[model samples]
Target: MSLIHALQSALGENAVLTQQADRARYEQDWRGLVNNPSLAVILPKTTAQVAEAVKLCAAHGARIVPQGGNTGLVAGAVPILGPDQVILSFSRLRAVRDVDLLSDTITVEAGLTLATVQQEAVKANRFFPVSLAAEGTAEIGGVISTNAGGLQVLSYGNMRAQVLGLEVVLADGTIWHGLSGLRKDNTGYDLKQLFIGSEGTLGLVTAATLRLYPPVATRASALVGIENIEQGLGIFTSIRHAAGNALTLCEFCTQPALSLGAAHTPNGRLPFIAPAYLLLEISALEGARDPREMLETVLMEALEKGRVLDAAIAQSERERLDFLALREAISEGELREGGAVKHDIAVSLSRLPALVRAVEDLVARTYPSLRPNIFGHVGDGNLHVNIRPPAGQTMADIANHKAAITRDVESLAISMQGSFSAEHGIGQLRLLGMAAHKSQTDLALMRAVKQALDPEGRLNPGKTIPES
Candidate 1:
């Protein structure tokens, strides 16, 4: 029997998709960037099935692109090698394998959506802090593979910090079961980490043991209007100094971006107009002081010091979700208006203002037809600065300038000792950035690791790492 027949035999025919309609759902990326067809899309329901599929693909000398939820911004989860590769989708492999409350960890199959994982943790009266707008559909495996960071990184850190252990299937179909929930295991090399952010290039992550935290007993959220990025950063500093880890989130948004987000608000109005806005949140275990009170005090001080122009503290849970809705809607709003030349760049907290200023200057000096929609996890120094085209002009109008715009913005981030790709992993999109921005030593070491783990390049070819 051939590979398709073998896959169908190993995993029921329903699990093996060969028709264009069956494979179409997994073909296009979240951004609709690539829609390359594949030879087959394998839906594995268990680790054994995943291993079997990998083994069969290896035997046939066919490449496999591991995907989860198909919700990646960088087109990392989609295939690019024409009709030769097969997609090993973990959608049916979702299962709550184990939940260790004592260890404060949850082991879940690769296909469990991030939101589902969060809900599972909540069912156990625990908290899983890796959150992003895509949490509703983005899977745990994809998040682990991308090492995604979101609003909460200000306090909890990225996906890397939350992963305690991982169960990975090697490129050659060997199952490396390293799902240990122990927080401290000073064993050999911490091999599980090698596959965490490898973008499915090194190995296929079948399941993961993720860290959990005590449920938030008290929480608070606020949206404050500020005069400029400096004022917004100042407010972030004060909140961090005062609340410490209680400050679970601190997001910055430009006025233009806020306008876009506000359009999605229930009232369809800007919360309170200003040059910039800061949407922040605080959470803590039950304590004498309410988190809302703590947030109020910090904002009061900023207001008294002229750092804050106007502010709205979430008075209830509904209001808090409303506040978050605005921040979350910013990206959708931008897309509705017409997508911009987007860049995910990061710098030190102190240099964020300078980076924003430099980008503004670059746009002003050249490409006068574009406006900036800058916003992100400012507390962690990551910003999604998208330069939008002037009203009525779509991305096509600015097509000629997109390359130069991305180059200059990325180069500015590098000049500030920042990264060109911050939270979003180097999927096929940023491979050019990797070749352009990554140092020689960095590329060589990355290639060495890739060679050791995936010698034949049979796993997710033409992604993450550029050709040497």
Candidate 2:
């Protein structure tokens, strides 16, 4: 029997889709920037089914592209040219396997949405803090595979830090059940780390055991206007000193970003306008000091020290949600305006100002008519620097400059000791950036690891690691 026939026989007819419309849905990524459709789309409902499919594909020497939610910014989740691959989507395996409130861990299927996990934690009176703009649609499997970091990363680290254990399906159709709830284990190797951010090149993650937190009883938020990036940094330090570990999020936004958001969103007006703006939030358990009082004290100190030009504190839950909407909607608003050259980068906290200055000078010198929209998770030192060309420039002209701009910006990031890919993974887009910044020895070691795991190169080829 043929490979397609074998797969269809193993996983029922409803699970295997071969029609053009069915396969087209899994072809493109979230940005609509890439479209590489596959020969078939396999929707597995259980881990055993996934293993059976993998074994069949291995016997046939076929390539498999594992996917979830299909909300990735990078093109790693889609297929590439010259490969008649099969797309294995985990959307049907949407199940919450287990929840341990006392141990503060939850085991969920990879297909469950991040928002659904958060809601499940809330139902149990616990908290799961891995949040992002795409939480409503991004699945737990994609977040684990990408090791995504969002606004709350300043307090609660990235996805890798929150995961206690994972249950992965190997390339040969064997299950590696490393799903332990232990907080500390002196076991050898800690093999689960290998597949956490491997981008599905190592193995397919079927389920995961994630860490949870105690629910916060009181939450407080504030929107502050600052004069410049320097003042924004100063405000961060002041709030950290006053609130300590209670500070959950500190986000920075530029004047142009706020203006664009106000122009696009129906109710997304900035609370107070200045050269720069920041959104600060605090969360605390019951019987602890009032979070609102802590925010007020911190803001008053910042005001006295000239770190803040103006500020507005939210008094109700609705106001807090409205305040967050302004920060979340800016990117969409910018996209609606025109084409942009975007970068997700990070630097040391002390060197952020100098780094920004150097990049700004370089852009001004090279592209005289470009305006940059600078904003991001300032507390974590990750900034999204987007370049918008002057009005009247044709889209083709702007599109042709991306290669040059990416090269210069990535080189500067290397010089500043920052990373080229901060939250976004190194998909096909950053293969060149990785080659330019990564050393020959490091690249060789990565290739060796990939080969050791997937010898046939049958899993998500032409992504994460460059061709040898």
Candidate 3:
């Protein structure tokens, strides 16, 4: 039997997609930057089905691209090669296997969406805090595969923290069922960490054990206009001191970011005009005092200290979501400005200000016509520095300037001891960046691991670690 027939036999006809139209969705990425045409697309519902499909692909020596929700910014879920590659999509495995309330953990199949996991936690009166703007569509596998970090990371931590264990389907058809929920597991090597942010190069993730938290009874959110990013950092420090561990979010956006969001997101509105703004949130356990009063107090002091120029607290749940909508709508805003070179990078919290200043100076000096759309979880020093095209510029202009712009921008971030790829992970989009920046020693170690796991280089070929 042919590979497609073999896949169909292993996982019914409905599970295998072969037609171009049927495979189009898997071909393109969320950003439309990477397009990898697949010979076939397989959608397996169960872990066993996934394993069998992988074994078949390994036997055939055909390259496999493991995919989740396909919402990743870096084309991590999209294939790199055409025709010969098989897109292994995890869209059907949406099972919640176990929920241990006493242990504060849940085991779930990888294809389940992140929003569904959060809803499941809410149903059990617990909280799963690994969130993102793409949560509604982003699935557990992609979340674990990329080790995503989002709004509440300042307090709750990233996906890496929320994960207790995982079940991965290795590159060579072996299954590693290391799904232990124990908080203290001192087993040899801690193998799960290897696959957590491996970007599907080492293996395909099919399930995970995730941490949960007590539900928050009280919450608060505010959008504070600031003098600039420098003062935004100062206010962030002040708020962190005042809010302490209660500070769940401290995200910032420059005027360009706010303007972009406002232009694209219908719900987006600027409460005040300043050089920059910060969206903050605080949440507390049941019976705890409302966090609004605390944030308001901090905002008042921030205003008094010349850090915050203006501020408004969300008076209702709708208003709070609206405040978040403004921040979340940033990408939509950037879309209106035409093509952009996006950089999701992170520096030390203290060095973030210097990075931003240097980025501004460099962009103004180099890409004289373009403006930088800067916004992100500043509390964590991770920001999206997207160089959106200037008004009236053509696609050709963006194409002409992309290579040099990306090189210089990434160079600046590396100089600041910052990462070129943060939560987005290094997919095909950043393969060049990885080759350009990742050190030889690091690459060699990574290659050794890849060879050990996927010696044939059939899984996610030409991604994450650069080709040797």
Per model, how many backbone clashes are there?
Answer: 0, 0, 0
lDDT of each: 0.89, 0.86, 0.87
Worst 10 residues of 2 by lDDT: 388-397
lDDT of 2: 0.86
Error in Å for residue 130 of model 3: 1.1
CA RMSD for every model? 1.3, 1.5, 1.3
Residue 330, model 3: lDDT of 82
lDDT per residue for candidate 3 within 1-468, as digits (tens), equals 788889999999999999999999998998877787887999999888888988999787688999899999888887776537999989899999999999999999999999999999999999999878889999999899899998888998899998889999987678899899999988689999999999899988999999989998988999888877788888788878877888899998998887777777775778889888889899989887679888888888777876678999999999888888888878855655565788889999888888888889988998888878889998889999989777877446779788888898888889989899888888888989998999999999999999999888888887898777
Check candidate 2 and list the clashing pairs.
none
Q: TM-score for all predictions?
A: 0.98, 0.97, 0.98
**lDDT (Cα, tens digit) per residue for candidate 2, span 285-307:** 88888989988998898788876
lDDT of 3 at 92: 92
Cα displacement (angstroms), candidate 2, residue 318, comes to: 1.2
